[model samples]
Target: KTEKTYELQLLNSEIIIDGKLNDLGWVDVEELSDFMSINYGLKQIPSKKTKVKIACDNKNIYVGVKLFDDSKKITFKSGSYDDFIDTFDLNSDYFIIEIDSDHDHQTSYAFAVNSSNVKSDYLVYDDDLIDDNWNAEWISEVFVDSSGWSIEYEIPIDIFRYSKGGSLTWGLNLIRYIKRHNEYMAWVVLPEEKVGIVSQYGHLKNVNFQQKKTFNIKPYFAYDNEEYEDQYYPYLLDENNGDISGLDFSGGQDTYSLSQSNNKIGFDINYHPNSFSVLDLTYKPDFGQINQDASEVNNTAYETYYEEKRSFFIENSLFFTNSSHNNILFL
Candidate 1:
């Protein structure tokens, strides 16, 4: 028989949310029953009246959660590692978090973010664990949510142990209580399934550090025009063909290209904490172009590829040119 290993830990800073994150004010992790609310779209069902909380000390990490379900229905599913490209399907609600820069091949940004704010994690499943290699000792305090529902969990710090040892910026995300009608949105943005691997969901920007560091700041801008031959301009993509064709045949006219141009500005600040460490990008614009792939590249590297043709990183991307929307994902 053969053996396998894993890593998922590193050094990093705290996450503080002072203002209202979304329109709703911050909900305390203690009295969760008062927070859960009923949402209409899905099934006119209310949120679970549960509490989700996690506390961590230097030596260990702890997570505490409370779950409230009136239906008393709970089910979980896990998948094997070798099931993508060769075997890919979005048959479940999965959210992932991967951390690199601390350990080695045993662990990586395979399922989440590193200590840096680079969005290069591809995960599967929300709320549930990804593999059997790791185990989470979870306990739930349930309740009936005529108003709504909720749950709580406790995760130990030993849950992760990576290769490279240094301060890191870990990514966080959650996905749960999703069905045909009702879907719980991701803490991180989840793009459409048809977009497949081409999306940006669950982005944890600017996770700080407390180790050797190199901070650099840069700001710039540019402008361009568009031309369309087809009066009915459409996005570029081939749901029919599995090949990637450029902007030529997607339904635009190079002749009708917008001869007009505009001007704008942007900035970037990155820190290289250690050799092989990544750059931080929490403050970077959601539409800023990225730095290009170096003439030399590393095998276990992570990066973000946006749809907008940024002046910075416009090449080496697997983007969907047809869909007319800003659909990004976590992976």
Candidate 2:
């Protein structure tokens, strides 16, 4: 590593922009595609043009994406991928972001929203055979800035762990509306047949600064409404298909799934221990809808991008991180 001093902390939501907000200086679909096409020599097909703006403070990264001409009248599809989706279920536009903290390309993070307003967070582990079972709270806000319509997201550094003020590269990919048009564009483009998460992304350089550490512990005290069912049914062996079983979710009193958003009753703690060495403790576990797999050590390419904050350890009420790493004598 070279010897240098760079401002590493995004301490507050205060972003230092070099100049004024120039919507004209924006990257459109074609311009972005052409840049990617020429550089990667990939015959990039075109997609719908969605205007986006980005800025960051010490505490949060401010992203303003303009989803133009969204046909609010149409009833878009609300579920997973299917053939011949009904006319009422085609959303005109949505958004996705592939974030790679450093240049290591083993796997990266993928988050998106569909035109029907459905939200999902998936892992681009093997970009080609992309599976969709990752759960992350795609929590964000949008308001009319003086410039244009903007989406403001407060993404926590603890959500994706890295040292304070540390810097790394990222990848960007955005899918569009108008499914008949079938458009998807990238910041750094790739091939036409390059379909899933792995093949599409281009690089975004230098973005991270752990200005502060905030573990938002909001344990809601509320009453359960749904009919709680605790039934351990027989597992099906047939290969036909399955549904989002209400049985799996229902509980004894009002069962909770160790989820932050849906289950808001328990004293769910978000621990922010002083030492970053507690890194071994923090884990972002798989969701309840589907507990896929959780044995991988290296998440993304960047040595600075892996932060596992799984809720299982918290809800179970036993913390192995401090107990194991510190060799604490707990009687």
Candidate 3:
């Protein structure tokens, strides 16, 4: 296939982001279609049809998608927030969009959604290496009907890093997976040797990225009051021999009620001086509030491993991508 490019235009008005394509701002926009399968080196037309449209404003990028299939037979699945499903799995329908905001082929941000409207976002490095632990705040809506399914996304521009000024162009790629047929289709289909990567992607032109200072602050206060019963130790002398008794021979046991209180206050700050740099600060950040890890029973002698959930360490952990498969690394 040849190189493809889509000219994105500025939105005329605010989009409702309701997963419907009936909005007037979506009218007359270019529709990207004609997806080709890159499965097993065979380039053929997929059984289903898929169409995508994109628009942007000063603060957010808007995307609308329409995929045609039998709604009754569609398989839907959901995962934890910010967690992605297996693309090759036969139990779920998947859609993904990757964008190289800085036009750096080595890095890109991927946003994905399934038929159940479960959204996930991550960072891709060196074309194939992915950091799934990365997280971002974005919005998506999904609607399924008898004909097929449609999706809408509102991705904040501040969530990504990009070039500073002038007319901008970004690398773009789209992927669709059909669960029933186990088919994979892509807008920019590549050769068999170079499949499923971002080294060679299409272009998004006419992008006017707005760069401004953005700050997000979250403050929390926790008050913990713990009350418990405590047992009191008594000094009992032997009745016959004035010696210390080894055990408490007293018939009555003394008990007392104790209470403890703790007050904690903290705040987290995420400051974006511009689209290219970020500063994260925490005043007594609370790591205990993160979701607990899933329970697993290990029957063998080996230790059970757990995934990291702290944002302080998982944010830019992709820099050491060459070290190991794990995202967070300690030097």
By lDDT, who's the top model here? 3
Q: Would you estimate the TM-scores of all the predictions?
A: 0.29, 0.48, 0.87
Enumerate residue pairs that collide in model 3. Answer: none
| Comparing 1 and 2 on lDDT, the stronger one | 2
lDDT of 2 at 15: 31
Per-residue error for 233 in candidate 2, Å, reads: 35
Order of the predicted models by lDDT, top scorer first: 3, 2, 1
lDDT of 2: 0.42
Per-model CA lDDT versus the true structure: 0.33, 0.42, 0.82
Off by over 4 Å in 3: 86-88, 194-196, 237-243, 246-251, 319-331
For model 1 the local lDDT of residue 161 reads: 31
* Every model: Cα RMSD to truth: 22.6, 16.3, 3.4
Ranking by TM-score: 3, 2, 1
Taking all chains together, the TM-score of candidate 1 against the true structure is 0.29
| lDDT of candidate model 1 versus the reference | 0.33
lDDT of 2 at 165: 46
